[model samples]
Target: MRHRGGFRCKPGMKQGSVSLSPIPTRIVSNEEFNPPPQTQAQARVESLITSLADEASRRLGVTRRDFLRTTGGMAAALLAMNAVFGRFFDVLDIEAVEAAAFAERQGDPYFIFDVQTHYVGAHYDPADAETKRKGAVTKQALLGLRRRVREAGLNPKLGGDKGTIDDLSWENFIKEVFLDSETAVGLISTPPGPYPQEAVVPPKEMAHIRDEINRVAGSQRMLAHGLATPQLGRADLDFMEMQAGTLRVDAWKCYTGSPPKGVEHGWWMDDEKLAYPMLEKAKKLGVPRVCVHKGLPLGPVEDYNHPRDLIKAAKDFPDIAFLVYHSGFKGAASVEETFTKTGEIPWTSEFCRMKRAEPGIRNIYMELGSTFGQLVITHPLICAHLLGQIIDAFGADHVLWGTDSIWYGTPQWQIEAFRRFQIPDQLIEKHRYRPLTRELKAQIFGLNAARVFGVDVHAKRNEIPKDYVSRIRMTYLEEGPKPSHRLYGWVVG
Candidate 1:
C-alpha cells in the first residue's frame, strides 16, 4: 500500500531503504471522516492513517496500530526509569534568578574571610625540588584517600590528579581559586603534622621562609599564620618575632603535635611550662589571636592532642582569642558509635561545655576548617545539630569559616557543602550555626577576621578589581552535572 506522503511498501517487507516525504497537513479527528465527496478534514485523516499504516508496514511489516502501541509503551517505560533515578527531583526548587536576586538584595556582606586554611610551602615554589619531591608521597596517598572521601558523601573526581606543592602556591594558588572569588581574605597554616621530621631549620632559615610567605601575600592582604615551633629554641622565637614584627603577621599557628626530644617537645596548651610562656609571648607581641590544633592529632604525638587542653588554655588567657581548630573532630568517634549501636551520641555537647563554662570563654571561636566541612557534608543532621549547639554555646559571631585547603585542596567544596545543609530556615536565621546571612557570611568570610586581627579588610578589599567580585559565585549542585563521581561541581577549585 502507498502512504499519502508517496512511499510504497508491501506487507511483511523487511526493507531498510524505505523513505517517505514529509506529511504537511494537520492531524485529523475521527469525527471528521465520511464517505463520497470527502471534506478536507476527512482527506487529511485518511492520509495520516494511510501514511502510518505504510510506514509501519515498511519498518515492522506490522499494522500502524501495533507500531503506535509499541512506541507508546517504550515512552512510558523511559518516564518510569527517570522517576526511579530521582533525576527529575527538584532539590532546591527555587529559580536561579530569584535566588540570585534575593541574595543580591539581602545586602549580604560580599567579602568572605576564610580564617583557617592549609597549604604546602613547596606548592607555591615549584622550583624548590625538595618540596616537589616531598609532595609525591601526598599524591601517592590520594588513591586510598579518595575512597575514604567517597564514604563521606563527597564526589572523588573533584580532587586534582597530580599532587604538587605548587598546588598550594599563593600566586598560582589564589589566582586559580581564591583571587577571582568573593573570598576577600584567608588565614593559612601548614597541614597538621608531627612537624617536619628532619632536624629543625636554623632560626635564620625559618625566618626567611616566613618572609617569603609575607612577600607573596603582599597587597592582597592574604594573611599567613606563622608556624611557631617553640622547640626551635629562643633563637627561633627571635626569628619568628622578626618575621612577625617585620612582616606584621596576622596571628600565630601552633601545631599541637610533639617535636623531637632535643627539639621542643610536648607544648600542650594547658601545660604552664610550655604553653603559658608561648601565650605570654604572643600577648607581648600583640598577636591578637592564636589558632591551636586540637583533636585527631594525626602524627606520633596523639598524647598531647586533646581539645580540652586548649580549652584549659583559653580559660587561663581570657584576654586572648583562641580559635579551636577542628572543633574537636568527634566525627571519627560519633560515626563509630552510631554505626555500631544505631543510636545517637552527644560528642558536640561535651565539646561545647568546654567553651561555655568560663565567662570570656566566649572569646573562644570554633574554626570550621576540615572538621566542620567533613561533618556537614558527610553527616548533615549531626552537623546541623552540632553547629546549633556550638552557636548556642558561643554566639554565631564567634563561629568562623576555615577551608584547611591545599592539604585538603580547594576551599570551594567546603563553601558549597555549607550551602547544601538542610537546617531549618528559622534556625538558620536565629542561630549563629548557620552563617548564611549576608552580614554573618561576610563576617565568617572576612570582616570578623579583620576586626580580630586588626587588619584593614576594607582597604585591602578595594584593591581587588571589580571584575573579580562579579565572578565569585558560590557553586551549588543546582548548576549542572559534575565531572567526576568523586567531585561535586559546587566543590571544584
Candidate 2:
C-alpha cells in the first residue's frame, strides 16, 4: 500500500503558520515508524528556543522569522538544547546573538556529500484515491507527534496539507537540498517498489534529476541510485543492466524487506541463487557500490530488514562495497531504552558486533540517515553512544553521512548539529571510543563517501563555487532567502 508520497515541504506556499524555531525539538517521522511523543527535555528545548528567539529578535530589531534565518538563530536553537539536555552540544552564549561569532566558530568547511536523499517526481498525484488511502494510514501513525504538538500549543500548520504532495516534489527538492543547505553534493535515492518502474521515484526519473542537477551545476553535484530487485530473477537482472547502462546509475539501492508481488516474503542479501546474479551484473557494469536499506523496516516482517544478512554477502563479494542505509538502526521508539539497558543499540550494535567479529570484512559501510536525525533530537546520549560504537567498531572512514533529507526539510540543521556534537568524556573513556575530532567528522561527513563514489573533493569544491547552481543560489540569497524553517515530515501537532 506504499503510495508515491516522497518530497516534503512547500516554503513558497502560504501556509497559515510557520515555525519560529530552526531545529526540530520533537521527533519527526518520515512516514516510516511512528515517532514518539515529545519528551520533557524536547518540550523545554522548544519553549526555550522560542523565548530565546523572541528576545534576540527584539534586540536585533527584526522579526522572529528573520532572526531564525540567521546563523545566530541556529546557534540559539542548539544553545537551548544544551540548556535542557545537558552539555552535549558545544555552543557559546555569544553565538546566540552575534552572527560573526557563530560564523567564525561554526563555518561550513567540511565536504558534505549526503549519500541518502530523496524527492518525488512532480507529476505524481496526491489527490488520487489510492494515495489518499495510504496517506490516511501514514497520518494515523504520526498522530502521537501531531497530538503532542497540538497539546503543547505549537504551530498547528506544520507542513500544509497531505494534499500538497508537491511539497515532496523536485522543485522543493532543489530548494531544500541545494539552495537552503550547505550540501555540496547529494545522492538521489528512492524507495523500492513492487517493480523498478513503479517506485515512488523511479530509476529513470532519478537519473534524469541527477543529470539535470549536474548539468545545471556543470560539475558532479549529484549522484543517483538505481533500484535493485533481485527477487524478480532474470527480469530484475535485465532491469539492473538497463539502469547501469541506460540510466548510468552511480550505485544500486535495494530493500530486502520489500519483496515484489507474488513473492511470499522478502529476500536476503546473502542469497546466492537470487541476489548474486544482480551483484555480478553490477560488478560487470562497473558500478561496484550497493546501498541496501537495512533498517527502518518497510513492512510487517521486521527480520527481513535486519543487516545480519549482509555479513555473508559482503564477505562473499569483497569487490562490491555494501553500504547499509539507516545503519540498520532498529527504530526511534526503542533506541534509547534498549541502548541504556543492554549498552547495545538494537540492530545497529549487533551489526557493528558482527563487523568486529569479522575484521576482514572491509567492504561493508554504515550510513546515518533517518537514524541519526531521530536519536540526536530525542536522546543525545544514545546518539553519542551509537556514533562512538559505530566508529569504534568500523573506523570513521567506513561511516557515511546521509540525512534522508527533503523528508526532514533542509539538512542544514542536521549538519550543524553533527558539527557541534561532542562525544562526552564519560562515554569516550568508558567505551574507549575515539573522540569525534574535526578530521574524523570531516571524513564521516564526506571524505569517506567521496572515496566510494569517486568524487574528487578538492576539484568539486573549487568548481562548485562558480557553477550555474552556485550562481542561482547566490542570486537567490542576494534577494533575501526564505528557508521555510519547516519539517516536511509528520510532526507533533
Best by TM-score: 2
Which segments of candidate 2 are over 4 A away from where they belong?
1-18, 120-169
| lDDT accuracy of residue 384 in candidate 2 | 92
Q: Cα deviation of 121 in candidate 2 (Å)?
A: 5.2
Instruction: Residues 1-493, candidate 1: write the lDDT tens digits.
Output: 3221111233432211111211111111000011012234324433553454455445555554443323221222222222332222112312211335324433434566787654334334445464456446434433334334434434333243342344333332343235323456666555323333221232233334444433332334356566566665575467557756875666776766545334443567777876677777778888758887665443344545567676677778887898877666543334535634743323446677766785456568877766654554334445665667766677767877776553334454355445333455554676545544445555565666667777786677565543221222222122321111011101111
lDDT of 2 by residue, 1-493 (tens): 2232222233232211236777887766665555566788888999998899999989989998889998878998998989887898989999988878988997658889999998743333443454446444433423433344335444234333332332233565777788888899999987666578988689998998898666545578899999888888898888988988898999999988877766758889998998999999989999999999888877547789999999999999999999999999988787767876888888988988899999988998899999889888888988998899888788899999999887677998899999999999988898898998999999999999999999998898888887656765776678777787756555545
User: Per-candidate TM vs. native?
Assistant: 0.58, 0.87
Per model, how many backbone clashes are there? Answer: 16, 6
- Score each candidate by Cα lDDT: 0.48, 0.80
Name the lDDT value of residue 96 in candidate 2: 81
